[model samples]
Target: MKTIAIYGDSISTGTHGEGGYEAMLKSSLSLERVYNFAVGSSGLTRKTPVGMLEVLDKNPVPKDAELFLIWHGSNDWYWGSGMEEFSHGVKEAVDRLRAAAPTAELVWVTPIYRFECPDGMAQAGEAYELPNKNGYTMLDYYEELEHSSKRLGFPLIDMRRLCGIHRDNANLYLEDRVHPNRAGYQRIGAVLDREIQRFCIY
Candidate 1:
């Protein structure tokens, strides 16, 4: 059986008051082995809650795993990482994973756009703010990584575009404005399934 590994942040952990897509994808695509190595509030940057060494030491990639799904950058982007720093972190992670799993394909999932908090939850956004914070939108960061993926020759999954397409159709997320609800996770899993089938299949 083929195997897939996920390395990412809170969204990957499904910590924003919602279940993650990892479990769903594992169940739906039972043919592929799945390992989720995600931490809450993580970032691509070494400064964040998790870094390459931590992920590697904690969750050693299984030799049989055929694909590595990298879904980081939310915390890094919000906490403050310019294109140069962001690209470096991502490249470093890619290099590490490549070294560990020489034959595995890498799939990079771009960060999603941030939504305006509902009036009641606006203050909540402020409490979680990071240092050197900028007012630039999340789309800016997503685009930066998207460009990097193009240059790096990795398959990029644009969650920002997916969210935009589905934003009007349903309650895609929770009130936290960060975590996606069950429906949202399902949506993500569907997209991942298609991408994995198209590109990562052995």
Candidate 2:
């Protein structure tokens, strides 16, 4: 059995008893082990002194990992990190992962679509107070990551487009317009599993 390593945020860590998308993928793919190196409230860009990239460096993936899946950016957008900064963080993270897993295949999983939450947005905006706040959005982050993936020659899975989570299905899928519920996670896992099977040749 092959081992898969996941580097992500709270979405990879289970929410409300749901094992999140990574757990779902583990079960669906029937892999030997799935190492989830994700933390809640972590983003690619540093909102705090220690960010996801720093966390990853401290806790490296196993040497035997055959694949690496990188999923982040929700918190970056929420915290209002500029695209350029986000891109730089991503490049650094990818470089570190490549150095750690020289032979492993790397894939970038774009950030999922987050529904508009007026209260949540207002609170985050006030707390972060990022510059050029009006121009930042989840889609912008997604597009930038897509470009980065292409430039870096890494495969990408656009979860936002693939998952099809829209306003109508937000309640059923997402717990708080940002995190997905159990059913929503299952859907994401299904799509990821298919993508893995289709693209990853073990």
- The residue-by-residue lDDT of candidate 2 on 70-189, one tens digit each, is 888777776567688888988988888888878888888887766543223443321112222545777677778888988887888878789988767878988887788888887888
| Candidate 1 structure quality by residue, lDDT tens digits, 1-202 | 3578888887787665356787777876674667778888777776666754467766767767788888876766555556577777777777778888888888888776444432223232321232235443455557677777887778887766764523454354544456677766777788878777777747
lDDT for model 2: 0.74
The candidate maximizing lDDT is 2
Candidate 1: residue 192 Cα off by (Å): 1.2
lDDT of all predictions, in order shown? 0.67, 0.74
Cα RMSD of all models vs. native, in order, equals: 4.4, 3.6
Candidate 2 displacement at residue 4 in angstroms: 1.2
Structure candidate 2, residue pairs in collision? none
How many residue pairs clash in all the candidates, one count each?
0, 0
